[model samples]
Target: MKVNIVGAGVAGLSLAWQLVQQGVEVEMFERGTRVGEKACSWFAGGMLAPWCEAENAEPVVLEYGKESLAWWQNALGEGFVDAKGTLVFAQQRDKKELKRFARRTQAYEVVGHDVISSLEPDLASQYQEALFFKDEAHLDPRKALIRLTEVVQALGVKINFEQEIEPEDLLPEKVVDCRGYNAAKTVQSLRPVKGEMLLVKTNEISLSRPVRLLHPRIPLYVVPRDDQHFMIGATMIENGHGHQFSVRSMLELLGSAYALHSSFAEAEIIEMGVDLRPAFIDNLPRVERDNNIWRINGLYRHGYLLAPYMAKLAADSIFSDTHEIEKLADFKIKEDRV
Candidate 1:
């Protein structure tokens, strides 16, 4: 059966790849000229730390996110998913905040000043206590998106850029909408939560993995990219303002980076970005099959962490013709055999 997928974001691209791999012809449409710009995944820190996310996310996040590490490795190959783990720390005043975070999460080892020095030598002087989640990983979202797109295209899936497709425009065996926040018109439960991030470059300090600096307010996460670049983000505002970055947010994010290491104060600010993430009422992803269109969305902050598994589920339902897809909206949806 031929499939029509709208939106070339991580969810859409991942789903297209899954369908095509099962010998189904896939055609994808994106309103943007390229795959990376329009989607919220572009601004993501790409941290796959399910244990850390469990502090605020539901149990399902950890359940599916644990699978994403291997899934992404298979999709994008080695060097794509960085397994350097995640280091979470706090300032002297925010020690309680760190302890509170540790109590809520799992798969982490409490590290003192000496251990922190051994793990990330640059951070040891600043933080006396930290929690190290050794199994956590991260990726460069842009690179992953591009690599996945290349693989899907090589598999003979057709992706048309600058094409905004509507349900009525396609006559395919199945139509899947992975438009993220743009699907709000069709999915009433979808809401856009604005997230802001900063990209900075510095050569003075080196870090191999993602780091979360805990605070009572304005917590920050920094994910190290190739070379001297690092991505710092933590803000999640309710309103869907996508025009520009807020001054207050900029100050806080940069301040958190400085708090991580004094060298960040001199790091060059390469870019500031803001994007709206699609989320459902429960802040969990759902696959609702209505008539011929299947809407997969509400990824929230777990796009990279959950899209692969969601894609597998969508593909299984499409091929089996037994599952309604909508009935699988429950958080307890089992892992797809694929």
Candidate 2:
């Protein structure tokens, strides 16, 4: 079988990888000049914390996320994933928020200062207690996307960058629309959620894993990257995307980072990114089919965590001869002719 995938973001790239591995001839088109240029996954925090995400997301998210964790490791190799797990904590005054998070999530161990210190010495002085989701993991999104592109290209998948063609334009060929927010016009139910993030470099502190700092109003997570770099994010603004970061978001993110560790006050601001994440009303992902076109989107903030599984589902439906597509989607859309 031959397939064409649009939008070379995490969703498209993952599907390309999956289809190519299945011996299907795959061709990908991207509007951007290159991978990660216009992709929201480029600015993602890349947390693979299914249990941590379970605090607010649906159970399906956790289930698929856990499967995605193993999929990523197996597909990309163990070295690609930083399996140090995730840490969630709160200030003394906001201890109730920690309790609330703990109540909603599972697969974690409550740890005191000693365990906290062992996991992240920099945070030991600031936080006395935390919930450790030891099975969780993280990765650098930009690196992961680049790696996926390389893997797919090596597997003989052809990618065309700077190409902007709608799924309808590729008629008669199986098409998977992983265009994300770009498909908002046709997928009327899709909405954009603005997310702002920051990249900071601080040599004073070191962290092995991602850490979530709980607050009543603004919850923040800091994921560690190589060479004392950290990805600090993100604000779930209901407004659409903007070219610049909002002052309020910056202050909240920086303040939250400072609260997590005082050294962040002196950290060099490496980059500030703002992008619109496509999400449905339920904030869960979906795989919808309209004749020959299949749309895989609505990953929200769980791009890296869920895109792999969504891509797998898309691949499965493309090759399957039965009505198993409905069973693979988080939300079922009646099959309709375009």
C-alpha TM-score for every candidate: 0.95, 0.95
Best by lDDT: 2
lDDT of 1 by residue, 1-338 (tens): 89999899989999988888789999899999997878888999999989999999877789889999998998888778989889998888888998899888999999899988888899887878889999999999999999999999999999999998785567445888989988888788788889999998999898988999888888999999988999999689985666588889999999888887899988998989899999988888887676677778999999998898889888888788745564323555444332
Task: Report lDDT per candidate.
Answer: 0.87, 0.89
- Per-residue lDDT of model 2, residues 47-70, tens digit only: 999999988887777878998888
| Residue runs of model 2 more than 4 Å from their true location after superposition | 322-324, 327-338
Q: Which whole-number lDDT from 0 to 100 does residue 213 have in model 1?
A: 89
**True-structure lDDT of candidate 2:** 0.89
Worst 10 residues of 1 by lDDT: 329-338
Q: List the residue pairs that clash in candidate 2.
A: none
